[model samples]
Target: MKSEVALLQYSDASLKPPLSPLFIHNDPSSNIEDHPSLSNLNITQQQEQVQQFLKDDWLPITESRNGNAYYAAFHILNSNIGFQLLMLPPAFLTLGWAWASVCLLSAFVWQLYTIFLLVKLHESVPGIRHSRYLFLAITAFGKRLGKVATLFPVIYLSGGTCVMLIITGGGTMKLLFNTLCENKFNAHSLSGAQWFLVFTCVAILIAQLPNLNSMAAISFIGAVTAISYCTLFWTLSVKKGKASGLSYTTSLSKDHSAVAKITDILNAIGTIVLAFRGHNVLLEIQGTLPSNLKETSKETMRRGVTISYILIAMCIFPLAIIGFWAYGNQIHGGLLTAFPLFHRHQITKFSMGAIYVLIIIHCLSSYQVYAMLVFDNLEIKYTSIKNKRCPRLMRTCFRVLFGGLTLFIAVTFPFLPSLSTLLGGMTLVPITYAYPCFMWLAINKPCAKGVVWWFNFALGCLGLLLAALLVVAAVRTLAITGLKANFFKP
Candidate 1:
């Protein structure tokens, strides 16, 4: 098979001018003989060097590539907006509205900075252009260390996230069933494990939909559902606050000990970090951009990041403030769960039901977004088919098996909140915060005394520290509560 550079060379002859002229040597007018690097090479060696340079500098231009800014924005929105958004209310309960907002904004800026670093690194390093996270790691850190850094985190994040999605989807399905059935079918009648199996089957079907671009419609709907449910949640929480006559308060509870408060605040920070953790798949989304269009990739990334931040700020702050004002310490895992008081109202029940449906849909769609990453990696590693698409039968069988594995894991460990926090600290912190900064530092080699270099270095250290603390906090919480091994337990 020809290298991507070779393919681009072929296409360049037929379509547009070569991308080499745009990136090669950063001096188009300078003769190859004038450049010290190429001047020493013979003609054949010089030609090969130029080809290698082009391959390193730009992603291959494909005629079939069709994504634009809107699709890219929706892709980010779908990936970022998941069941965790609903957990913002509980996060706010721990941190209070003021501190929660501050943390949320800080996380947003931190994520944006890291994302910019990753994109700039991709552009700056010729060898890593259009590469996945793993390849980027290998290019920067060498094979052994790169595989160690990339494989474990990517698997842990993608695979663990898929399992969490199953748990959340199953739990939400159970809630909807109980509500609609009027308690006729309680937790005993249909177990959460069984519902997980059911959703896993559903995801198995969705997983066979081919590729990421094919799921754009589902992603668009998922984004809309996320926005709608977040709006409805904020509205209901505000209504509850008005009825309860409690003002939005930023004060921490005096009843809790200082240690407990600090732990809760750290847990809240972990949850927020998890909510913002979609950087793992940014490169995949970036790949969808038309490779020939100059700056389109960067612009698409900017638009997507802007849209995500705006939506997060709009949804999270209001829900946090109102939900905390109304429920205080009573708030639990999700804002939706904090609606028991309003359940008596028909409108509230209807809204909750709709929100549950939306959550289920969001989970299903977002599951594919992450699961695809895992599938792609696995297929490349295990399958005989390389360069060409995997056969339909092989794809279906692989997905079915993968789905079963995820289902088993979800049933075995059904603790969504704790699992999410663990994944955030262990997988997401590195992927979102540390790795990009480290990669930028390695690839760009910014000035030692420059602000950018020190800023990223500080952020990397902070990310490591934050991950360690959050992991410790999550483990401690689990130990104190004792692990619930019974899958049938309500």
Candidate 2:
């Protein structure tokens, strides 16, 4: 018993976590020869020995921080997918799913190609480092084709601003109408209020008159208005008719399988390619970031592509599935219509609003880029003529003129969607995809390259095929829509 007690005491005193001694003695008077194991060494010596053992055997700990980065990345990805789901109708998900997948793949490849070209363009220009010039080139090219690039910004801004106004305006009118119905205010009844709203719209349009650049502004506005109405044609696909939950279902026609398939291809391609339509802005992002941040931003771009493309696929897939299952061929903007049911909360609303704002800003910024390019090109032309930057007064005058033109479109038609479609589908398509592949082809000869070279060649060919398809689709859509009255209708 005494020996056991002594051993227990010895062990309690000598041992410690992480680096514990072998043993210790409780009794100070115990002879060293009495217990060879316990009396051989003091607690200090045992601890030292234990620590040495640990030091020899222990491996370095490696704590990874990339987990959180990956989490954030996936979160962005899911959100993008959610947006795509909201856009896609369910019908295509069932029958036209295959075609949609093809479009998305094509869109992704095109996006990569487009960005590459923009980078190449940057390298091509010597010492001229303004991004806005790219936008100018688009405008210049479009103008040669009889489309006004500078005039586009005005139209896009007007459509968004006016649509928002109408939404707000309709709400205000509804409130007033309800008040009149209840005899709560002196304002007239529903019909009277309706007339008042029409008059108000007219009055607003008239006030915006002096700012008009031409019929171009009005035409753009009307087109957007038409698109807005068409947008409402798509039905919401909330389960139990609930307004907030997962948007996996859609309301689309079960018929018109072939038409839906074709539409799905076009829509999927449009969203994936157009959603990431800020390669111009990427240059700015890269330029502004610090070296480390820039590298991080490059990673961010990769993450973004993966995230957005995946999200687009997720959203569209389920939508195409459910849309076809339910409403079939009648699926319009099946993705967005479903939003009201799934996104009733303020946070969701705010997030969606922010996305819309980002898209709008992206579109508007694109116009600014075009305008700056035009100004730069014009300045060079002016320099050639008179050997100086265009006079400040003249510059200011042009800015005001352009700014006013934008305002006019903002108020007048405020409804055009055709301009963006044409730009994105035809010119932007080739410039972004075809040019990059060719540039890479020119820069990297195939014989010197093995896998990478052939991969690039394949990518270029894919881009060319997509661009050709875009041109054909765009022309076909335009022709079918008719050119007799005003062919620019959305």
Candidate 3:
């Protein structure tokens, strides 16, 4: 614990967070290498010496992090958008177009600011890098509390995300086959379970491609498919023109009364929040870049974030507007499922099938991005307990187990995706919206009652309030809907 404290930079004694070692000092502008204590060493020696201070060299994210800005941007794009965009249109209708647009843009801007906070704080400790959320959490809170607080959310998020992807990807693949071969292949059609197995098989293969940074090609494909499908969905909807009749009303379970509408709106905020999924993995994304005082990884991270989110905005804003205009409260699910694909006058079956292909591909890469944190945790735990490095065979087995477990859960509980959305309302909000603000205050405690201190305090409180409201709304929804799901229905 003392050695770990020695490795990291610290805040002033007056503002230090509750880490194990109580030593504290103000963080200087330059990195540890530039600190006077280490100025005697040669440049190469200093760089290598700084490397000696990182606590978790055994972690997977720390292995061969040779990725550049473009790769980081690609992974960010892959993580941020997916089938979640499909649900955003409904949020628009529920919030009403004007209010919905405001919420959507506001969430985007808010998340963007929070992610920047995470990036800046990644190397707040000079020679050390937070690299992973667990490390960052521990730095902000102390070891025991941080470890307990962070591990569950990260585990559930990674596992739940992978499961939902399998469900959605497999279902999308099944849809494509049904669309393309409606008149044919009836005698030998694969069931939804088989399609899920197929998706899992492909994901397992992608998972074998070593470290997170090494999967740049796969991430690139995921980013492209996400953008492409989003474009196709919105463009096709706009081509269909507005519905014959429309009203400014929202529907959930076909109920649009005052009470139901309010509940529906609360749930819709969850939907929008989940769409911007980058925060769950942003620190790890930064882990793949090189950081030093000369050219910090935050610069690369911010650039990539700017580029990726600009593209995300272009895809999502138009989609939300057009999707709401076309279907209004009538949209029951995704834009693609609002009506039969083959029967649509403006959309050909071929294009619809292509969109499904993109969805499968995007989900495949998304699984890898989210699952990396779980993989790192598993590997690190093994190394810690055994007091030795995790071998290749054991690492391979970990990937297999992760892929298999998510596959089993996804296949057996197709309805988990719906439930998971509500769960995400409770679980994801703190991690995404609240944690960074609290962390910033703890690590860089500005003058009390000063602008920086009060601003962060207010935002943190706001985030907590929003999370509490979402949790209450989710509970009300579950109480109303009841947990009715058939086993192995998919």
Candidate 4:
């Protein structure tokens, strides 16, 4: 590759002439000897050497090849928007959700910092392979600490898959059971034998999900739906306020009346934290983009982050305050249930249906990405004959299993809130707060001078504290309540 690069540069005459002028025309033998024009070429070569040295030494090497910017941007938007959807409803309601969001957002900021740090660290160490810097901690601690250390990645991958399956099967079933069966209590009342069959099918199906790239491409359309839904909320809120000829207080959820101010604060804090989980998607996005267009990757991520925050702040804050005040705490997942109250008198039922369908699709796309990431982490691969990537029999079996499994969960255990809470508390919390801080510490980045480093140190400490708190909360909830939740005080 290096030789090819040099050859490509040599081909550019505009860049520099390789042959000396004295050796031109008839004297071929003179070409083998040093000529006066060769001195100029020598000078150019020296300058080029200096420039190359600086570029190679000081900068992170970007790929020479480039691809379409639009496609790259679309890729980023798709994955990130899924994180955004995963964040929204949780951000408006749950206490822990706010913490989760903050952890995620912090992780995103840290990811950007890590890229810069990795480059700076690489530049600081001379004559070192980039992989040495990249994986030194992994090699030192991971390879040498014991056979136990080798299990971390395997554990992470396996745990990830399990979390994904649990959430999808649980969330989908919850949505289906509530929407179709209209059963509130005893939602998962299947017999023991029936439960066994249900889980077996779900396990097989979730084990055979798609890759990150495919999910990102498909999610772009769903993100547009999310944007539209936000628009619908804003337009309808104002119209409803005008029609009622009442104050903003009237539009708030009424069930929240009996709740204490501290609970509201806690809930808001949790919601804010959960809203920040958009960071995790950025890591995968950064790697996926063509390495040649480094600047565009940064800009694409920045735009996505900025847009996500602005959209959520505008759409969710008022929605939460209004939904909680008007309907009270009875609002089940803000996007699904809370919207109708704000525009109950204005939009037709058909319009509501359109919004519902859009939300479901958006949710499914986001859920699929989460599941895919989890499965991929597990090193699970499934092939499709349409792409001739996997064997035909396996692909057919995989699809049939997944579909049947989803349907089983849909029929048996349809409880979205509990599933989200459990999954968010267990997997999302650790992935966001615990892992980033641990990874940072693992890298052993020497603390720099002054207040900036101290601030980061403090932030890392806070993340650890929050992570510990979440673990305790999750454990307590599981012990006392089992898997069932009573989010409503009643």
| Candidate that would win on lDDT | 3
Deviating ranges (above 4 Å) for candidate 2: 1-102, 113-272, 280-331, 334-386, 389-392, 405-416, 419-422, 444-451, 481-490
lDDT, candidate 3, 1-490, per-residue tens: 0112224333222322222222121223336543554466687955544443332445576665567889999999998887878888878766777788888888888878888899888877655567778668877987777767666777778888899899999988988888898749967988888999999999988898768888889899999999998897777666667667766574544646777767778888878877777687888888887655456677888899889989989998888888887778777676767845323666677877788889899999998999888888787667545645678889889999988899889878888866755677666777888888889988988798899888888887887788787878888888998877867879
RMSD of each: 6.7, 23.8, 5.6, 13.2
Steric collisions counted per model: 1, 40, 0, 28
Which 10 successive residues of model 4 have the least lDDT summed? 17-26
Whole-model alpha-carbon lDDT for candidate 4: 0.40
Candidate 3 error regions (>4 Å): 1-58, 248-258, 339-345
Judged by TM-score relative to the true structure, which candidate is superior, 2 or 3? 3
Question: Of models 1 and 3, which has the larger TM-score?
Answer: 3
Task: Give, for candidate 2, the lowest lDDT window spanning 10 residues.
Answer: 56-65
Question: Residue 342: error of model 4 in Å?
Answer: 6.8
* TM-score of each model, in listed order: 0.82, 0.45, 0.87, 0.55
- Give per-residue lDDT, candidate 1, residue 291: 43
Which tens-of-lDDT digit does each residue in 1-490 have in candidate 4? 1101111122112311111001001112223123332334676774443333222121111111122334334433433433223334333344433443464465456534543333333212222222221133332245344224323433332333333444443443444434444455565655333433454454444334344444444556656765666556545654554323322222224555443333443334344444434334334433333321113244544454455545545554554444333433344555455556546556676676666555545545454443443333222222111211344455446455544554444444434334443345444444444444444444445566446555556655665555455545544545655764332110
| Model 1: lDDT of residue 443 | 72
Superposing every Cα of model 1 onto the true structure, what RMSD results? Answer: 6.7
The C-alpha stretches of model 4 lying farther than 4 A from their native spots are: 1-211, 214-216, 242-268, 292-335, 341-346, 378-413, 437-450, 474-490
The whole-model lDDT of each prediction reads 0.68, 0.37, 0.76, 0.40
Residue 153, candidate 3: Cα error in Å is 1.5
